[model samples]
Target: MAGGTVLVVGGGLAGITAALGLADAGRSVTLVEARPRLGGLTHSFRRSSRAGDLWVDNGQHVFLRCCTSYRRLLDRLGVSDLVSLQPRMDIPVRSGASPRVARLRRSALPAPLHLAGALAAYRWLPPAARVSAARAALALGSVDPDDPAVDEESFGRWLARRGQGPRAVEALWDLVGVATLNAPAERASLALAATVFQLGLLESNDAGDIGWVRVPLQRLHGDAAARALAAAGVRVELRTRVGRLPTTYDDVVVATGPAVSEDLLPGDALDLAPGWSARLGSSPIVNVHVVLDSAVLDEPFVAAVDSPLQWVFDRTAGSGLDPATGQYLALSLSAAEELLGRSVAELREWTLPELGRLLPRSRSARVLDFFVTREPQATFRAAPGSRKWRPATATRLPGLHLAGAWTDTGWPATMEGAVRSGEAAVASVLGRRTERTALGATA
Candidate 1:
């Protein structure tokens, strides 16, 4: 397994990460992708506008400073400077329930203590509820993410048992949880909730600092990854779908989605359990892109509460839109079931008023263009008992491994998880030897 040919299927972040790692380790690797470009989830498309042609991302994706693996991938791809991290952890939140806009920014302090100032002044919840939220955070920090019992129950019920009211869930937990876990507290697993909170918030003050790509997603992920992979001397095959196992390679890594993985995994060779594929479900994400005559948001991004808007990002600069003409805003709605089937016109009609309500500047701004992008199966639904469905990187069949966000990486389905899954797969493949992975240590 040291220097033989390795076939890595799927050109997404996971495949790119794996291919780069294996090639850098002096292994001959062939990377194949069904799509014309790389960066499976994080991609962009061209949209014609009166101002000029612009590149709009499939969705507005962001990562936290805690996502070390993904940041490492960026650094490896030589595109780390293309993204921007917040100077400090700050989130401007606008709630339809209240007229006042609340800011969730950290102070100069240690872990957990850094958030005290922001949460104390958080106007979304009552003073009593804020205190309750603090207590809940402390309780959540104690819940070990690795505990199996924690996955059997929903996070919403746990919050209720701890005296968390509806206001606390919407204003505090779901505000962060929905974006991170891709489900409401009632629907998400307690294990993932605890993991997101403890690792991103409680572990360190800087962990929750948000980072986003300044350029188009295609530039940051697809194009940059291709450049890095080529420079690494890995043979890349695009627009080539791998339906069957190739005999040219000694080892193979399936880095596709769960549904795709089921089709690609040879049942006769791999002793997969019955209905193993059905165990992992899917979730949807809806993104609304709007081109306005003028700027509405001063900050680059903001989270919304008591409204349909989950997170809104000002992508004018990212989209390369002409500032002299107007601005471009992308509204990201995770776990978007209701909006998935709706037409773009219908979505535009509904979201424009909401934008107007949240940003007074948008009321007078003329809508130049509006569009929507939907990922029906954006990621596997991280429901209660989902952990049992997720398989390990090492498969029952030798020389065959699974690498995707759906794989067991402790974290949920994210860019960080995807990259970690690749690293884990490489670690499993090279575990027989004493080779170190690109992630630094073994496995």
Candidate 2:
């Protein structure tokens, strides 16, 4: 654990964090990644164009200010300046083209009281629903995420029992739940939802303040992490696939996706259950990127209600789009199983009009180009009983361990969970106690 080589398979945030943690602890680390770059799911690409090539992220990843571990990772990589956190929690939420943009803002008050004004004034929900939302939020703060019964029920069912109806679920619950849990409230586990809501919104005043990278995710995660780890004397291997566990290292961390980890992990080496990985089913996410002739959206980010647009981010600067020519916007659709098979042309036809509806400036602006990015198995489905499938960092095989967002970190499949799992894996390898870092949630 002190000096022997520790092999970390997968170049994701989880793998990167583990490698860095190990190397910092005076242990020789080798990070093997199947992809050419470091970032696994969170990456960027170059979009060819007649004018010039543009840098675009594969998916939009948003984090909260309370994500201390991820923030520490950023600091370690020396890319902390590449991202910015909002001054406070202010979400521009639109419900169709109602001309009324509901602002979900938080005050500087203590927990639970910080959001009372925002919730009371939320225009999307009726007055009665807003009252019920307060009650429900308070109730969520009391629910324990570790209880087996909590994971067995859907957040929607719990909210319904607390007087939340369809309108409230759509305007309030789904608005936040679907984006975080990657599923609707009706399908997401109450345990995960409770963790998201309690830690993110109810526990602290600044926990929900949003932060996002100003540059491409590749630069922020993959390239920066690679540079950081290599400088620490860590052996970095890219575009390398380990079909079987290599016996060269003292310890190996299987940090790949859930299904891929199950595949790469030797059957006879560990005493894991045969159906363990299978139980953590996957959920899909679809991202629609559009370049328009004008800056339709003024805000950096926005959330939608009663619209196909779940969340939209203006990536004009990040995408290297010439402000004088056109603007670029990326729309993230979580739990996007229905839209996975849709063609880009079909998606463009509908999404453009929806954008125009939300932003009147887009009504007359011409669409320069449109494209879609799909992740069929983006994250393990955080539905009912998912906690039972999530394994701990330690495995039966002392030489091999696990690390990924799918593992139990008391959070959903987000950047925070990925980093937390990595640290946990490192702690397991070092035979040290794991210290829980501060962070609210991730995308």
Candidate 3:
């Protein structure tokens, strides 16, 4: 994996990061993708409109300020402004709620106090629920990172122990779950939840600041990544799905989907007990794309706490959709297990009513068109006792390094985690000169 040439299989951020890092280090790198695009889930496409042209993303994706590696990736792409960063954490939880907002602002005070205003002002939770949520946060803040039991219990169990009922869990922890594991907190491991929340929310001020691309996902991720990698002398091939890895190619890297990697591994990967071992199950993310005649959601994004929609992102400006003409809304329904195998028509019938209820403007608005996209293996099931299932960056095979959101990057299965995992693969593949060469923009 060190000297001659390295083949990176996958065109996602993982592969792009690895290819850029490796090629910049003077290694011959070839990146291959089964799809015509490289951004994977974050890719975008165009839609025709009466006013003009419209661009929309495949899914609604967001990152926190804590995602430094991802931030660096954007900076290196020279499109840092292409994504909008919230100065603080401003989550409009529910429109029906009295205050209808929650802002997790970073303060001049210490880290704990920085969160006090947010917790104290969280109007979504009842007064008792708010106090209980504070205690829960304290409990999570104090958990030892190295504790074995931390990885064994579900976050729901921990919250239940701390007196969080279903109502509170929905208002509080489920949102955390959607942002972290992309699964319900009740079904996710306490360790992963604590890791995500403590690091992203409680431990650091400015940690929960939100960032979403202000362009089509493909433009922001795949197209831009391809240009950057090509500039670094990496050959990127799309629409070349790799079914298996060549065993003889010792310096190869597998940045493909986890299922693809599991299908290609030559060694006793299961016997070695990778972190992905425990998280064998998959979760579904169903993003219902709604094309509105006019802008329905004025906010850039909103988290639907009381509705069937987990989160909604207004990609009108960024998706290339003319705000004056049409709007594109990406509805992300996480842990959509039951809805995975359904048809787009079925989803529309089921979803539109709920969305319209949450956003009164949509009541009389005729949906120009609607579609549904599903990711069956969107994320590895981060249930209790599931941490060990994540694979390592350095695999059993020398050339076959691994990169995915599911990798043991200590971060949740997020864009940040994906970037962190890619960075790890990059650092590993560059070898000696990595410190001097590949680490240029990344470090």
Candidate 4:
């Protein structure tokens, strides 16, 4: 299979990683993307306002130190310098119920103990609830996310059985779960939730340390990837849609969204019932971007509790806005089912006062501009029994593979999952090639 032609039918992180890995392995790779730009769901666009033209990302995407694959992809893209990782895992969590801000900063202790200090002192939960939460976290460490029984149960139900009340869920579990899983604890699977908590928080001390892009996502991913792919001698076809799988390539990687993949793949390719993609479903994310007359939020980002606002990020630096000008903030609202259909005016009306409540300075600051970005089908719905819908990398059809966050990457639908899926797809493809070569040699 040396010098074999490989066709990757998506320009996302998954497809890009697969293309690069294949090309580097001596395959003639061609990446086809229907979008004009390469960075699939994670992209940026220009917005005009009185302040100036700003580059706004579709959503505020962040990564953790545990996300080795995504970070490696960033290094490969040569844009590692364009992002910033925290020296320690520190999250400024603010609650609307109280004026005081709580911090989820990890200490220099060992696994589980590293966060004990922060959890013990958390003001959001009662003293007993905090202890219960800690105990539940320890219990979660023992829960194998790969088990089929775990996938059948909901995280909320599991937490409830362990004495986690609604307060603990809202103040603690859902704080991280909703953002990562894109579904609240009641609806999210225990398996996916366990994976996020164990790998991100429990397994290692520094694994949960946060990192975010310093520049626009397009520049960090799409543009950098385009340059990297070109340098690697991989052919890229932007704005090219494949209605049906091309038979010419030695192997094909369908790395698009589940719906798109379903459309392109042969009916018999996957071992699933009809309408699996539809059954897998999707969740929505609504990003409310606001420009103020003056700076309100001091930190780079802050998580919210007891309010509709989820996470607020200071986008002044990344949006290309002048410091002298007002401030730009983007509020990332995950599991935003109700807010998806709300009008911009309605969002502005509701969100302004909420921001004022969270950040008191926002009440006095005049709004320069306010807008919204919605991703209805953001990620595959990580509900209970979702694993059954997510197929493995290899399909029943030979030389055809699947690569996406929706694939069976043993992780949630994050940048890490997408990159891991791509790597897995590459391994599957090359592994099959080696098997065939060995068989031929034996014959």
Candidate 5:
């Protein structure tokens, strides 16, 4: 087990974490990735505009204070200062159906009770529905996310059974579920929804405090990782595609997407049935970037209800846009099944008018630039019965493991899940090596 050679495929957060951990443990690790960059899904690109070269992220990704593993990865990469976390959780919610803007800010109280005041005063929901929502939240806190029965039911049906009507689901449940789960309550599993609520809201008061990157994702993740990997003595091979699993390495960690992992692993490596990756499915996310001549959104970000706009974030600082000249905003559209097929021109037409209704200042602002970025396979679809498709880190074949957000980490497909999968894979690899060494010594 000492100084064993390990190969990590896919240079995303999972692969990067595995490589760094293995190298630090005195293992010779080689990280390979097909893409030219390292931060797989979370990346950025430069776009030419009249204002100047604008840095645009593929998608707007945010993490919570509860995501310790992901934050540790950021610290390890030496880019912890490049991101900012909220002093406390506060979200400015705007509904196109109503002119009033609601706030979902938490107070300095304990779990469950911290959100009581916010829920009681939520302008989107009726007084009766808010009370019902609070009761449902408490009921959900008790649901075991690891239970097989919980995975069999939809969150929406569970809410309805607990007296949560359409208004509660739309105004309260969907507000959080759609952004985090990447699926509506009706399509999302009760198990996954319970996990998000319990860990983020019910379990602790500060767990749901949001954090986002202030710099381009590329600089924060990929660039920093490259420097860290080099210092760790891990060999990094970018733009290298491994058609078959290499036999030379003592251990191999397949950290690619489900489809890619399935193709690379041995037929009998995993215990799951055939076509499990396909059954796992995927969800899409579309990001619309808009540059205006004048500042429209005053806050850092805002969530929308009863409108096509899901979440709008001020990207001026991150994109290096001159604030004096204009403003840059990014609209993050999750579970974007309907908008995926729409043309760029069609999106601009529909989005501009909607912005006028949601943010009145946008109506008079001159349009400088408008573009869209789409990820068809953004994340694994977290629908009912999805846990069966996500396998454990250890494989049937010895010395082989899987690392990705799609794996069974008891969490949804998120950055935290991805980092946890990598850590688990490393643990499995080292644990097996120790077992083999013990057997040899006894012999």
Candidate 6:
């Protein structure tokens, strides 16, 4: 525990979290990052605004009330005041020719009773559907995440058996799936969807309430994390990728990508040997940003009820813009496997019309150019039966810990997972002893 220096080889939120956690715990550490800046996927840059220079996130990210760990990170970084938490469970879902909005609220009745009150008065649902949706929610909440059968059935199948038909599923249950997993009901795993619900809704009355960033992703996450780490006396190095570990010593953290992890260890030990580690897969995300003449959206973030666009975020005030001619909107397409290879032009062809259709005022709005960004492997594919593949924070290699959203953090591959993985990696590193990694055909 004395006179030991650790090297963490990444600068994403997880890496930053690990470094800071270790440093705060009285450990000396150096962080190496491959990119010029930190923040990994959540980044921002200068964009033109009527009020002058502006910053906006690549895409908006939101959290549920139950995400206590994430909130604690914000508080530690002193940015808690920069965000807003929806005080009540309010979901505004809209679809089709005429937009219909339904807001889900809670009552003092408690647990299933609160859910029943919200569902009984849910106007968008038919009388029969309201009852069916309630039953389905109850059924989903009652299902145990530990049960093997939960992962065997598709969420769509489970919903259907619980009385949710196609339209009702799209309007109600699908919102739950896509809002959480970034996939529609049919595409997502029943176990994952149920976990999202059980953890978010049934477990607590206001836990499903949303919280989103009031500023750009990079400023809110990367810059804040880097600054906090530096203040804590952590050495933060960016653009210095580590291809191999300093084998001269036995204590270090490998927080890089799949290739780097495999490159560092003996006999291709980190290569996962086509087993647990090798089984890691990824999903794609597509983000589109557009500027209009006026504020097209008021909410900080919104999940598209029954559309291919999973979520949308409004960046007006945060971008230093006048509401009239300086409103920016970002659309995030999660699990965007189909749209991964499409050109931005082809994407805009369909997306622009959809946006206009959703926000009628945008029909007459002037186009201030558009931009789209795609990440083919933004996160690990969290499909059914895939849970067994996600590894823990510690590996067989001593002093070599893993930190990423893919690790088993009892959460979907998310920002929270990334932060949690980093914290776990640090804990594992701090507990390391005089032992070293074996140099044999490791796995």
Per-candidate local distance difference test: 0.87, 0.88, 0.75, 0.93, 0.91, 0.73
Residue by residue across 168-238, what tens digits does model 6's lDDT show?
87677766666567667776668778888898888788787788877777878888888898898888888
Worst 10 residues of 6 by lDDT: 434-443
| lDDT score, candidate 4, position 383 | 98
lDDT tens per residue, model 3, 98-118: 325565455656676777777
Task: Give the CA lDDT, 0 to 100, for residue 116 in model 4.
Answer: 99
Model 1 residue 84 distance off true place after TM-score fit, in angstroms: 0.5
Candidate maximizing lDDT: 4
- How many residue pairs of model 6 clash at the backbone? 0
Ranking of all predicted structures according to lDDT, beginning with the best and ending with the worst? 4, 5, 2, 1, 3, 6
Q: Which run of 10 residues does model 1 get worst, by summed lDDT?
A: 434-443
Give per-residue CA lDDT, model 2, range 115-182, as digits (tens): 99999999988898899889989999999999999999999899989999999998888988999899
Q: What is the lDDT of candidate 4?
A: 0.93
lDDT of 4 by residue, 239-339 (tens): 89888776777788999999888877777788998799999999999999999989999999999998889899999999999978999999999999999
What is the TM-score of each predicted model, taking all chains together?
A: 0.96, 0.96, 0.90, 0.97, 0.97, 0.90
Candidate 3 overall lDDT versus native: 0.75
Winner on lDDT between 4 and 5 is 4
TM-score: model 6 vs. ground truth: 0.90
Candidate 2 vs 6: which has more lDDT: 2
Expressed as tens digits, the lDDT of each residue in 1-443 for candidate 1 is 45867889998889998999888888888999999999999999898977579899998889999999999999999999999999789999998656579999987799999999999999988999899899989999999778899998899999999999998998889999999888999999999999999988998989999999899999999999989999989999999987776655667888999878887776643355756767788899999988999988899998999888989999998899988899999999999988899998789889988988888789899988888889999988889888988888877666778899988888888899999999997886666543222111111
Candidate 2 Cα outliers beyond 4 Å, as residue runs: 268-272, 432-443
